[model samples]
Target: MDRFIWSNRGIEAGETKLFSQVGVRIYDGDQKTSYDDGNINL
Candidate 1:
């Protein structure tokens, strides 16, 4: 179980890095609109 948790965290971190590298914007629930810089919003 501990290994599984660590692997999951690693996957999440990798995904976040990939997203940032590709200019993906991940906003909170309350922030539904894109910013003025025009990056991809999700």
Candidate 2:
């Protein structure tokens, strides 16, 4: 079990962006995925 928090501040399209993400993960085999609680596509 794990927990995380992230934040990114930068310029985007001539504007400032503050993208944040929060996630939790548990591993027990037979399962795999990506955490995207915020701007993961950015």
Candidate 3:
């Protein structure tokens, strides 16, 4: 749902490129989560 809205705005704003997400996060029975989204070079 968020992607649809973002793409609409991006198109109208002439956005032609993107550098994004590079990781995952999950929580188990231990109530622990892991996330690693590195860096955004741009």
lDDT of 1 at 11: 44
Model 1 regions lying over 4 Å from their true place = 1-21, 32-42
Where does the lowest 10-residue lDDT sum fall in candidate 1?
1-10
lDDT of 3 by residue, 1-42 (tens): 122121213333545456644453433555544423332211
TM-score, ranked from best to worst: 1, 3, 2
Backbone N/Cα/C clashes per model: 0, 0, 0
User: Candidate 2: which stretches are off by over 4 Å?
Assistant: 1-11, 24-42
| CA lDDT, every model vs. true structure | 0.34, 0.44, 0.35
Candidate 1 on 20-41: residue-level lDDT in tens? 2334444446664343333331
Over 1-42, each residue of candidate 2 has an lDDT whose tens digit, in order, gives 244334464545765535634464433365654633334412
Each prediction's TM-score against the native?
Answer: 0.21, 0.17, 0.18
Give the C-alpha miss distance for residue 38 in model 3, angstroms.
Answer: 9.8
- Order of all candidates by lDDT, from best down to worst? 2, 3, 1
Model 2 TM = 0.17
